[model samples]
Target chain A: MQEELFTSGRNIPNIDPYLDVWHWPIALYLFLGGLAAGILFFAALFYILGKDEVYPGAVKKATVIPPIALSVGLLALIYDLTHPLYAWQLYTTFRIESPMSWGAWVLLIVTPIAFLWTFSYYREAFGGIESKLKLFNKLKFLNTFEAWVIKNRMNMAYALIPLSLILGVYTGILLSAFNARPLWNNAILGPLFLVSGLSTGAAAIIIMSKSMKEKHLFGKIDLGLIIVELALIAHMIMGYYAGSQVQLEAVELLVGGEFTLIFFGVVVLLGLLLPAFLEVGEIMGIKIPVIIPALLVIIGGLVFRFVMVEAGQLTRYLY
Target chain B: MRYAMVIDTKKCVGCSDCVVACQTENNVPEGFCRDWITEVVSGSYPNLELELRSERCNHCEEAPCVRCCPTGASHVVEGGIVLVNASECIGCGACIASCPYDARFQHPDGHVDKCTFCHHRLKKGQLPACVSVCPTKCMYFGDLDDPNSEVSQLLKDRKYKTLAPEAGTKPHVFYLI
Candidate 1:
């Protein structure tokens, strides 16, 4: 085994054997974008479904936050790049084989779509010229046109739902491409990210909606989404446990290694459980307001990102 | 043309002469280094084996630092030497994070900095500072494309390997275990 290891022609002279260097930035981009994509996906879904009645004013008010978060998230990603100004080159020189390149394109497309969807909705409610015309203007020549053929505000927003979901899942899949990093190289990461994104996005929307007094629209959705998120978290944990020993050790690092405190305390208990408990209380006719739990969930979600990004890098790849 | 380095671990004495030479040759700032040596000590006190790797920019053919750079400051030179255009850098630390080997640093001036393989010296037909100063003759640098070059001959005659070849960076540096 020792001879094979040395004779494999895989060692670098005077260079420490380490995992791929691009892992840190790529991981960070995946985490932040996944969260943003997850939030936007849910927001767009609820809006297009006309389920705003369940959450009331909250959904409408909270709609603005996703784009803002996504934009900020993108900035952080670009900030991680050595040459941030060359970010636009991703579109110009697209590489089909590179997941980062794919992510760049997805972010580019989703960012604009999300912005337009939010803007159109805002214009409609606030009585902007474009919004008023869109809402009230009649096209005499286009009366015979099929309703589905014409682009409408709600239709535009509906278009974003699938794209946003892809963006969310793409984050996970991006990391999975790194077969070198045993911790990150898993088929389950994609779905795990998808589920986590939904939960985190829903939590962010709920909290932001409360601050904006759009609680009517945000309240019920928050509870439902939180419950769904908890289930997903459970499944992810179970899946992580059932994988290879290397993966299991990686999971243990999250659950019991250096990252245990943040993972268990902040992510699991405070982020997932407390919010879930609050949602249960609300559903059961208890008077417990969700603001506290919502805040905790958000903090937990962010900490979860921090922990995942940092912990994944801590372990040295032995193979 | 692909230029490369081959370092034999057996001859390295864990002395940091190469590190000092690289720093001095480049006028590298205090508290920041373009190249350094990392010592890995395994086993207990008595039976420990010390492995020393002199690390710098790998000047990878598919360098991620160049790909992730937002400013075009990080790039590959003619001889496949990865370099940073310090003047064009904005100190964003993107390269630092993107580098798998942690080879880059954001200098005090907020520019991305890393080993250039001493382009100026290479242009004048001289070896890199670290390669020229190694007392044990552990480090060798030459053009890989030229079969007559020392590095090419060594690569063909002996077993050598690169770090993280799976990354597809295609680093020019090789290690003889």
Candidate 2:
């Protein structure tokens, strides 16, 4: 029998795994990106599918989210990078195999399109607010572009739907492409994130909707998206359980190990199930406060991304 | 030519000489390492067996870090040694997440760092710092394509194993029992 070469005692230290490369900046970026994508997707879809009169100001308010959320998310992403000043390197070339490359291109394309889409709501953006300021008279050149935007607004909104969907899916794929982390490597992550994005997007719209019917429409859609998100969560766990030893370890980390409390207690109970219950109660003609479920859904969506991004890194194949 | 490494686990003393040598040679930042020793203990308490194994980047042919790199910073250079271009690295940590071995770490200066198989030494016709500094002569490095190379000769004679063969990354580093 050989003696222990280096016992974990006073002499030798145990090396902990390096699993915290990503932090809140990343989590915020993931949440905001998905939120922005979802908002634009539904706004464009509503513009194309439903009667314009049914939701007069819904699309315009929703359009506001993508530009603000995405710009902030991009800032968060850039700030999180080790080389914030050298971020231009990501745009210099495209690697079809790299998800980050796809993400960079998607963001670049979406930024201009989102800015254009915002112009479609020129009346909403600069309606009476612009005229009150002396600067509006100085910038009379904006009137021509605003008219053109209003004329082709429908066509522009239609073009935004697919781009929004791509952005939502790209957020998930960014993590999924890391095959080393089993928790983030599942193929279902793409749709799971897309559905979560839609749910949060719907919740955002519901919070800002002017009409009862518009609120109800987005509320019902959010409920459906929440159901799919929950189903995907279950599928993701089951798949991990039935997967390789490394994958099973990942599930253990989430289900019973370090991340157990947060994953189950916060993400599932507080974030998902509670909002779902409230949504169900509202559907059943109960006087459930719309803000309650809407807030819960948004909180849940953010927590879900936080837990996954942080806990997923804790599950390593080499440890 | 495909570069390779062969480490005889039986001969390792777990003194961390290779670790210190690599750090000194590569100037690896404090509190981080490009290579380290893992102590594996097995058998019942009364019939215990202990082994010390040196671990580092396997530099796989199907390197996931290289694949997941957005800017092609992590690349395979001459003799299949995996190296990183610190200037091009965005420090996004994508490579850090994609590395199955956990061999990569985020350098405080902001780029992902890992074992490079000592390309600088190889260019100078010298062994890697870890290989040259091992007191037990357990670590061997050379091109596997040359039949006369020590690495190929060792592989020809020893019945060996690899860490996480199921990973399917086809790592170039081999272990001799």
Candidate 3:
């Protein structure tokens, strides 16, 4: 009765004692991917609605986050792959049910669009680049492509709306598809990641925008997205709470166990609630630095993915 | 025709002959195995129940690993044996995360690797390496579709349970308690 000890026979390195198949790289990839999706989404959405002038940050400024974020995110994904050189195999066939397949195809088609959309506005963003370098004028296609893109930019906006939504949600569905992991086994994860992406996207705009109206508008947008994300998180936790015994154990990782402090404190309190309250205060005439709330939301979004990926991998059906 | 395994947990001594046989037969690589043993001690010490069984890929009927595989790499073949086409696997670890069995590993050659139910042996009309090498004769493998098969008879007669039954993976591995 004093003590009891049990020896583990399930000893397989990298699998047996503790499952460590996915790590921080996967988490980082997911966060950056969602962020890029969000940035592309709002940028395209406002352009489609003819609010390009009213929300120049969404269309031109924050649009810059996509190309940079996508490149880094994709690199993280490639870095995680044990068969990094074989990544091109993903494009050979499309498994409609596979979220990774969807991710591959979507990124392939949308990544170029994100760059092209940004390039279309390069002249506006860097008005005198051609004059300063004198080499830009030699690439006549660049000017012709810019003019063509500028004309059909609305069509690109139309395409990005659906594609961005898929990319944003794809990050979450990627985890949820692993029904073997009880923590990531909920459908709510899709919308949760999507809303978090929107919030993070809006935060990017708020960080980069110089206009007071654009900053204020995005603060409100991030605030709204954070609310939706919190609600989704609640629904997800509640689903787990009311779900099977395995799912209860999955939620326990957040509520009463290893993930409690970070999930509630960092992701919820600091990432979502603190930033949310700050945004509300700003609306109520309390002046706050835009960087403060924006950075908090971005950091929260990043940590949320880490929590989900790390904790989800730890939750298994066999335990 | 579904091929399956039936292990008599009550007779298993946890000697790990199955683990070695699998490694040698399939060339499963160092520090890795296609099958292994698990021991559980439950209840008070005096009345404790000890259960030992060899475990491997369940070759699930509703295999999530196959479903989640992006490049059609992890797939089910004849007799419901799940196999990974190493060349096609991007090693995204989706199938790894999706498997309730924890049966797969990233091979050193940079591809997904797992138990193929001794597919090469089966093709030659031989028993799976682990089943044939079990010292206790506690392990049995055959086509469950045939009523005369030892696995079918044992499962029909013995009180057996599968691992993670709640997962609804429809696991083909059975442990006769």
Candidate 4:
């Protein structure tokens, strides 16, 4: 036996120290990015699908807000990095195999497209002469030349949907890659993140539109989207409970373990349930302000990230 | 070549001599460790058997930490030892998140840190600090490719195992139960 290779010796004592120094900034970044991605993707979907009738002024307003929110989200992501200056390296040195590498590329691609789409809307708001310049005029295509660009670029944008879905889902898949920590290791994490991204994105757009007082033509569509979000969340929770015993124990950590209260009370109830109830109320002829549910849903989305990121880290790998 | 460490749990006495030796040799930061041990006690108190495992970067052939690093700061060296360039590390903690074994830590200088299998010592034809100071001689280090090397011989002769073989990391570190 290989055990014969060594002579006997004394044992060492163990120390299990908690390393919880990081907070806020990391959590904030995850929340902001999820919101930004969610909002931008939804807006693009509405514009491409010609679903304007379902949510009148929503696409226009949504197109304007996502770029700014995305810029803020990008800043938050850079801020959370240990070395923010090296962020440029993500663009310069790209690796197709790594998800971080892929995310960096996706951000690079999405950021400019989002900005151009947003700028197209303000070309008229900001004045016309400047909009005539080649660059500005090209950007104005999204608003003025929508038919030509969409006819030519529609396939390109359609290609972006799957890519965008990958970008949204990559965040959760990143966490699940750590197989040692049973809590984060699940095949379902990818879909869960994708759904959550859509939910958070819709919530962000709803909140922004209400705040700006842009005509809430999209209220019914927003309500419909939120209802879909609720269904996805329910599926995720049920899957979390019925999966592997080891994973179920890990889920217990979120449902009632160390993170139980926050996960159930803040994320599940306030974040998801309250927002869901508000949407239902709107559908049933009650006028619960849309902002109230939007805020709650956004908070819930942030809390979901907090719980997943922290809880995944907290669980130990027992071999 | 894939460099690896074979640990015989039966021979380990749970003494932390390897831990301290590794720290001093590497000049690891305060309150942070590149290598440590975990003890899992099973069964009732009266019949409990203490299992001790020394943990460190597995120097996986398909290392996830290196893949996750945004700056190319964390990477696998020539010998398959996963090394981090402290100067380049932004301490983004992404590598820390990627490691399945939880073998990484953030240094005070705001860089990701972990065991490098004592790269400097290896270059000088010496054993790693942990392997050199292991009092019970529980740790064995060598090139996995060389059939005559101590590690390869051990693999050939013993029914050894590795942590999370299902992870497909092809970790260089192995255990002899």
The candidate that wins on DockQ is 3
Worst 10 residues of 3 chain A by lDDT: A1-10
Tens-digit lDDT track of model 4 for A201-268: 77666765633333243345555656666676666667767765556777778766888799879987
lDDT of 2 by residue, A95-134 (tens): 8889888889899988877877776675564577656765
lDDT of model 2, residue A119: 67
DockQ value for model 1: 0.09
Q: Which ranges in model 3 have alpha carbons more than 4 Å from their true place?
A: A1-10, A128-131
Each candidate's lDDT (Cα)? 0.66, 0.82, 0.88, 0.69
Per-prediction fnat values? 0.07, 0.45, 0.65, 0.27
Worst 10 residues of 2 chain A by lDDT: A6-15
Name the candidate, 2 or 4, with the larger DockQ value. Answer: 2
Q: Number of backbone collisions per candidate, in order? A: 22, 0, 0, 8
Candidate 2 CAPRI-style tier: medium
Query: lDDT of candidate 3 vs native?
Result: 0.88
Chain A alone, TM-score per model: 0.75, 0.91, 0.95, 0.75
Candidate number with the higher TM-score (2 or 4): 2
**For residues B4-31, could you state the per-residue lDDT of candidate 1 as single tens digits?**
8898876777577887898799887766
lDDT of each residue in A1-319, candidate 1, tens digit only: 1111222122321122443234344445555676677666766676677776555333354556667767877776766655556455555655555556667777788887666655545643345664557643565433333232334646656767787777877777665554434566567667767766666666666666534345423455656666666676676678768876656877778776877787888888888778777777776778766677667766776676666556654443333
- Model number 3 iRMSD: 3.6
Q: Whose TM-score is greatest here?
A: 3
Point out where model 4 deviates above 4 Å. Answer: A1-22, A49-56, A123-163, A207-217, A241-245, B166-168
DockQ agreement of candidate 2 with the native complex: 0.49
**Residue B96's lDDT in candidate 2:** 79
